[model samples]
Target chain A: MDDNLMNKLAILAEGAKYDVSCSSSGVERLNNGKGIGNARGWGICHTWSADGRCVSLLKLLMTNSCVYDCSYCVNRLSNDVPRASMSPEEIAMLTMEFYRRNYIEGLFLSSAIEKTPDDTMEKMYRTLDLLRNVHQYNGYIHIKAIPGASSDLIRNCGYLADRMSVNIELPSRESLKLLAPQKSFEKIMPPIENIRNNILLYKDERKSFKKTPKFVPGGQSTQVIIGATPDTDRSILSVSEKLYSDYGLKRVYYSAYMPVNEGPNLPSLFSAPPLLREHRLYQADWLLRFYDFSVKELFAGNSSSIDSNLDPKLNWALNNLHLFPVEINKAPLEMLIRVPGIGHISASRIIRERRVNFLDFERLKKTGCVFLKAKYFVTCKGKYDGESLDSEFIRRKLLNKMDYQQISFLG
Target chain B: MMDYLYDGTFEGLLTCLYYNFAKIKATGIYRTDTYQTSLVNPHVAITTKEQLADKMYEKIRKHLGTYTLTDLYYCFLSEKDGFENILLSFIDLCFRNGPVYAGYHTHKEVIPFDDIVGKVKREVQRYVGYVRFKAVGDVLYSEINPEFFILPMLASHFADRYFNEKIIIHDAGRSLALISKDGKHFIMPYTETDLPGSEKEDHITNLWKEYFQHIAIEGRINLKLQRNFVPLKYRKDLVEFSKPK
Candidate 1:
């Protein structure tokens, strides 16, 4: 019996690996003494896989069997791969055992459609229900909202899960039609919209009635496959920005498309994945979320992609050099963070340190700001540390410090 | 220059701080166990006094706030060579210049103090996830080999997490263990013995090893990046990194 379960686990985990949304953050739940686990607001990663991605949750699928055929998916109906499904009891047992041993933070449960969309959704819901109610597990759970599932079933799953996400697999509608022909914006967008509305309503209700159950307290997120289509970085980031502003998303994961099945519409199987481009997109995503940069600000000119050599923030600094040399001692928090090397942590540290003492060049270095890059952009106590304020000279100096060899396709 | 020696404990270090403030100024502070004899300087053995240490603790908390006190405690836990002198000088600077000096990250005395504290805190965070347990009868047992004395820091996090399970987290490097059961937890000195050999292979452990390998994308196999997060030192205790016998 155990051998059978292990085989199913290996198959289901392989099927779910491509979805790439394993974060267990944005929720803080304490174990109620009788339960087995609790969650921290800033999540913990149990271990990292060989690919260097954080294994914060036990990422697995309910079943590898599917009805729909998406060309990019390994578990699509037409693919000849090992097929298996785990009973809800088996999934709950594995999650509890792994979580008890500290092998994972929680369960990241997603599934390919075994039959209809509702059938897959119901099985996922049952697994969450068993873990939550039967096993009394209080750890983090991130579940996927299968597109075209019934609204009531999705709502029930949201209450048991910490986070819910609907994967907008392809960025553009045109790509969606050509690649994942069965899926569309019409099926994908509604569940995300419903989740956003319900999260707001539940939060407001909890304010009035403290006993009201939390509905997806970690908020919702989505993933988009990059390099699968010709979608520009501008368009991709704009979609993320709109999701943040409109849907109030917690995060938007961008997975570089890995060619699994050979198809006319897909990239050639032998071609390398666009790892560098994906890294650049993630950098821009961080700027949008924390550094107060807009999608428009990232791509200022006719260029459709972010600069390959420099990071988005440094690239932005090079384009808008007139804004520098920002005085470290007197610049506001907003302007200070925009400096090339000063991150949100260092920017706030500078603010606090300046309140007690006047920051000089030596003092600024001690605040943990990256002096190699920030020296060209920021002036400490009105002293310019760089040789010249010219953008070209500064860019050349900054590029020299970066290790260009690490920017290969495999990286 | 006078060298003061005390028992290696946070309370003992605080008493040394009390002596520096109220009694006599010392050039060097050393833990009693790790102190080396010096012909040039006269040594003073400062016994750990609960009253004196409590007074200094209250003074630091009242003036410097709880956060600064916590940082000082973390630094003491690091048990690094010459950390006692660094802590003394940092406390002296903070007291002389008021509480604002604690936030002076660029200051000479604050820099080394913050660095030691950061290492200790980071180790605590890493162990929170890296700790892997195996069921031995009713108790869940795990072992860790960390550079610093971080068992005290990890106590509350695991106690709240595994409140219902009888868990023992053994720190083999320091001969300490955090034992939690019945909704309460405490740290004490413990020595471990080898478990009796079981003929049967554990199925769950095998399943976790399989899942770890299957999760990584075959095309994006970067052992360099993997080692960056899970360093060579930590791989010994991790279940997935261990080769199956």
Candidate 2:
């Protein structure tokens, strides 16, 4: 553990930590022979940060020394912080050595503002270029899109990296203005828009040509720092919905803001970034993406914000009682999945199995639907036995049940 | 008292049932890893020929269905006392009751086998969540001596994300597991049969090096939580966090 290697590791890992795009998504791969490692289909990374994220990759800093002082950053030139940087060959060698030893799934190379965006991003790109072309490293590589760098470098990076992320760190331009005066929304949006158009263009070209262009096969994903600005859940979600729909982003990661720096107007690190609220938004986000639940139905009776006590879907079901008591035997897959205790797998199984024989509540337990939670929401053969789905009553009952379980477990 | 011994195949296990029902003074049944008694001696060992094993495997399949065959495999893997008697009882149910209980929930004979399989599944789930990896050059390395026979099918889980990397998995207990590279993989036998080092070695045994490098959250040091999940017994060949050996 030389002081130099340790410093390079620390500075780079810390710089990389602020980026929230390390997810290894899609179906997992088998560890075939001749490769250095394998992916767990269920995606098991070794450890997680306090905010519940996986750390499988050798997530580290290429360099932490920054010339530009972004308001949201602690490693800015004006701020007093230890600095370190890894050379291009050093970064690529470390990544290969780590990959060979099964220390990481791949490399997630990022850098703070080193000398210039061109020089720093060029250093970053060169390391990836070495790993890809020289070493023939084909493992997962996630690189950060250097802000204000020319589109040519960003475009070239998109070809080699498995995933590329340009964080919309602040929610709106006003927040960006107040916090990060040096950065602009205009500087950010174009790369995303260009990447989207270019990704489509590459796909079209590949469809007709023998040589397929390697254009960000995993597609582009971005991160949003939650509670950093005065943005509502609605505001953040509206932006996320737009990112998914408009720019064609793969994932819109929600990172709970950690105020590592101090200022008068800047947020303090005391109030734990609403983890539960973040969780609610993730569920509601899933509902919109997968479950066909509109954002409006989620906010029908309540105010714009998400409920902290109950899960968003269950919260919606409580208000709309008439929709429930849908028969598990005959209900559509859409409605069946909405019922609590029934996961997507169980719903599909029900749809398939019910074709052969009528499914009753007793048999539904073995059918994989959790009857304990689903009992209140669903019925079989017209058997409905649950209290009315009034919001207050359901809320009290659910919370009381949770409290009872917790107290008894503690005792 | 007589010890009815059989060959080292699953059918040889079922053959024990065939012989056991002929008499009642059955006691002290154990796998032939060690221990010899004057009563049965050792020569009477019955071997589960590939044909016989397949035949009995098919019998369970015909009467008890596919999942019951799964139960039988796990029941044999359990290494519990009187598992033979429990298995014999289950076979008796296949004969006594009809084939309705093959996939049926409310049946008499399937409960014990079901219980054993459930326990195995729990261990599987825990291993799935808790399994960690270490890189050795280009090959990722993992070693586990699980309480059950689970390593053969675990590769399907880990290979996707590591598509370009190669990995090796060793079953410290069974002495062999698997080594996969590129996209090709094969299971090879291993044993603590050879000497590495005892628990007295200093520094990481390669795996410890991997685990130390794996942690990104240095601030969240919860050894109690890690120990609770990993347990002390399974930590020996882990190489990374294990005490010098």
Candidate 3:
């Protein structure tokens, strides 16, 4: 209610708005009758921001006084912006108040590395401690793991938070050196590796024992700044694939870099954020995670960029035309999922629905399959709608459909 | 042609289904109001028989999986015109074909029923996000005018979530309220009454509006995408859309 606190809240929240990693809770924790809040597995989006992104958490920074000057960051030390810091108690109080009013699912506590990485992380840890122990709030909390924070500090905070993330802002080590002189892959990668090992260890222990006090039960994630330092989609997706495969990360967020802070290294102030590119990357990322796609298969014959005209699945399907014309009723689950416009849910539906009776084109439509693009690739009981097997024919039809439905200028 | 007429409730629909299964040939099952003007078919007024409804519900669970039972409930909740008849035909198909009916997405009888169920469930999911509660006296109150009668579906989620608080979630369109007090919850017909919001509620709401406006990045302002998620129909009661008094 204090005037000072309101200004601080505005400054801190504005600093934290660029983050896109707080959409889902991913952990389901029921209230133990005493706690003030409960975490649902599929997190609730309390409201959609004007930018059309979900505002699930009270995303705020502990302080906007940074020691490091990342080129893309609005809160870099060199930038002349209003600075503010909240006490751990103030943060906990604010989170509980917002949560009680149902304005937010929980807190997404990040910081500007005010004094040092460890110092900033410690303050965040204390805030989480205050929320959990002092306030008895058990909502979905996602806190940032400061890149250079010590393992012990990261471990201590992991116990209280549902999910933790360390943003790998730059795609490659070379880009990190060029744009963000202070950060390196070496500093960021270790905390992620440590969290993964501890999560695995805790999982094993919890299986044997009942009350292990869940350590980052929602798992860990990271973000990459797209369009910042000329990193190719291949380079970006390669890092994402590595994070998922090696570190066991739950998600890798792609933030279309907004040119907030201008520098020789950063994009021009007027250059549009590569939102469509970011969207395509997300589509490709989902393929990598869910559609059994490998980085090698995605960009065969040394292509680095994703197709601008088509989605990753359709692009891949067009390139591998020999594999298409898959019989809907007879095709296996893996093959069905690989087909363009057949998502995991619809693929499963097709598989289940076909066992009782043979699927026709009309039946496949009922299962929510994208018939426009899918008709070209799939044969329902040897009946194919697409006239030609030529890849150009299918591609042209899809492009025409995309033309009518394009929402943005990029399309 | 024989037409079955029943009160527009899930149990009433199920009771009609029971008679249809017991050698009563149904050209269609319509709500009593819907069947009143129909000229071609002879109407049978089906009473709310709890035993018959229970038997049909159990038979549905046994023949089809629990998923179909859920779909049946959702389809009934959809309240779309002719949805009851679609449910009857879908159930009849399931009864004849056994569990295989679930996999027959291509079947003429099954598609409409599944689509309605999906539509209703989708709306139920949206209401979970769209329902905004305001502090009113000792309890929180939220009112929704959703297309579907989602009060029964929304009740369990809100009860588990705000377990401690006494909350009233009113479906203004359906004139029903799912009220929770001391962890116990039930749904009943509710007429609109003036429930005064707390004095602090408006102040807190304004702060939230400020946060909402500030959070949106200036570079990305897509009204089409925002509207797709939070449609205009549901925006009337949401705090962010409300003009300050």
Which candidate achieves the best TM-score against the true structure? 1
Give lDDT tens digits, candidate 1, residues A206-238: 889999989999999999999888889988999
Instruction: Evaluate all candidate structures by whole-model CA lDDT and list the values in order.
Output: 0.89, 0.66, 0.85
Chain A only: TM-score per candidate: 0.97, 0.89, 0.97
Candidate 2 lDDT for residue A82: 76
Pairs in steric clash, model 3 = A353-B103
lDDT per residue (tens digit) for residues B35-145 in model 1: 888889898999999999999999999999999999999999998999988998999999999998898888888899999999999999899999999887778899999
Residue range A285-341, candidate 2, lDDT tens digits: 887777777767877655777776677778778878788778877898888888866
lDDT digits (tens) for residues A1-411 of candidate 3:
656776887788888999888765688887766656788887888777777788889898999999888888999889999999999988888777677767788899998887888888899999999999987887899999998888999999999999999889888989999888888988988999889999999999989999897899999998989998878999899989998998899999999989897899988999989888998999999999999898878886889999877899988988899998999989899999999989999999888887787888887887888988899999988998988878888888778877856665442
TM-score values for chain B across all models: 0.96, 0.63, 0.95
DockQ of 1: 0.78
Model 1 regions lying over 4 Å from their true place = A400-411, B197-201
Task: Please compute DockQ, using alpha carbons, for every candidate against the native two-chain complex.
Answer: 0.78, 0.20, 0.59
Error of 1 at A364 (Å): 2.7
List runs of model 2 lying over 4 Å from the truth.
A27-44, A47-52, A352-373, A404-411, B1-143, B154-169, B177-189, B192-240, B243-245
